[model samples]
Target: MRKLIAAGAAAVALAAPAGAEFASDPAQHLMRIERDALETVSRDRLQRLMRAAAEADEDVVRVSYDGDWLAGQAAPDGGAEWKCLSEALYFEARGESVRGQFAVAEVILNRVESSVFPDTVCGVIEQGTGELYQCQFTYTCDGAAETIHEPEAWAQVGKVARAMIDGAPRALTDGATHYHTKHVSPRWAGVYPRTATIGVHHFYRKPVRVSSN
Candidate 1:
């Protein structure tokens, strides 16, 4: 009876599956499972990398300095900041060329960066308001009503403002924080360093004050 039982046990061992070695050793089985999982993860990672590379190869739209380019763009809309900037450009620079409009926007944005001026677009534009001839932007304190009369001109400046607020390069102005029309030479024009002259505007960078102890 003992010999018959041993023969049956050996027959069962011979009939085990192909991975009997792994089945017999728990550590080996766990290692095989981990290796398969790692392989699957590596395949997934490779697929993601390939997809990103393909996407990177697609065309990207960029800002252009031209009238046709602005006209081609869809009408833009934005929040308070955009409205303030658009209004400023509309009133101050509606007659300016597209390049000139961007230059004026650069001055406003540059002022926002300077410690001397308000940090926000609206704040910078509205500085010194409520008094005649006291505001930073003349249009704000000019006592004239601010209204959007020309849809075409307003739309053009709206696009300019949007492009500027969306991180358009300020190469046109050379970091100008102040600008005036070519017709008027303000007292400060001689004080600050003139950086650029674009269209009808002359751009200047405010001089840094030095203190003598």
Candidate 2:
């Protein structure tokens, strides 16, 4: 009986670690394994959760633009560009609504398409002249070091940025070139078509006319 009890105790001890490992959050466990394996986890998993949060469903893990809040958040190195853009948007327009943030991204992409601006987002954002706001984004020229203070906002923004970069349809903006909060309307609104009103901001697109010769 003593030998049998000892064998049972040994088995329990061996099984404890495996049970603990299995009890861990599946998403987190997979993430850790992926990180150790150098495998890239799809950003979609986080993006879907973010979209749900944006729609006011907060049961999902709360993310923010502040780096401090994300100290123990998910994989840090996942999607660098997405993280960069998200941090930029957080610092630039955290006060604005989600739609406003998307509009800001649209404007950056629009500049990429225009002949007057650089071809890439980083290029367009960083393009500027000395002592002047020559760049497409004022933040890049305003001499403010891009830093994330709100982790939840940054995480959500990271999801949005990742979705946008991955060719998720830009259906909300309708190719909008500009947007502003409903509290104030820009003069250019009169010349453009109002495409969408999301959150506090109204999105406008440049009207395209088909010429008849």
lDDT (0 to 1) per candidate: 0.88, 0.62
Per-residue alpha-carbon lDDT of model 2 for 1-213, expressed as tens digits?
Answer: 657655555555555566676344444454455476554334665777788777865333443433444344443334545655666577666776665666677766776676666777666656773455665456666776666677777766665565556554455677776676688766888888888887777778766566798
Could you tell me the lDDT of residue 162 within candidate 2? 57
lDDT of 1 by residue, 64-93 (tens): 889889988888999999999999999999
Q: What is the lDDT of residue 144 in candidate 1?
A: 94
How many Å off is the CA of 120 in candidate 2? 1.0
Q: How high is each candidate's TM-score? A: 0.71, 0.51
The residue ranges of model 2 lying beyond 4 angstroms of the native Cα positions read 1-84, 114-116, 127-134, 183-187, 207-213
lDDT of 2 at 7: 58
Best by TM-score: 1
Q: Judge candidate 2 against the unseen true structure and give its global Cα lDDT, from 0 to 1.
A: 0.62
Indicate the residue-level lDDT of 197 in model 1.
92
lDDT of 1 at 107: 93
Clashing pairs in 1: none
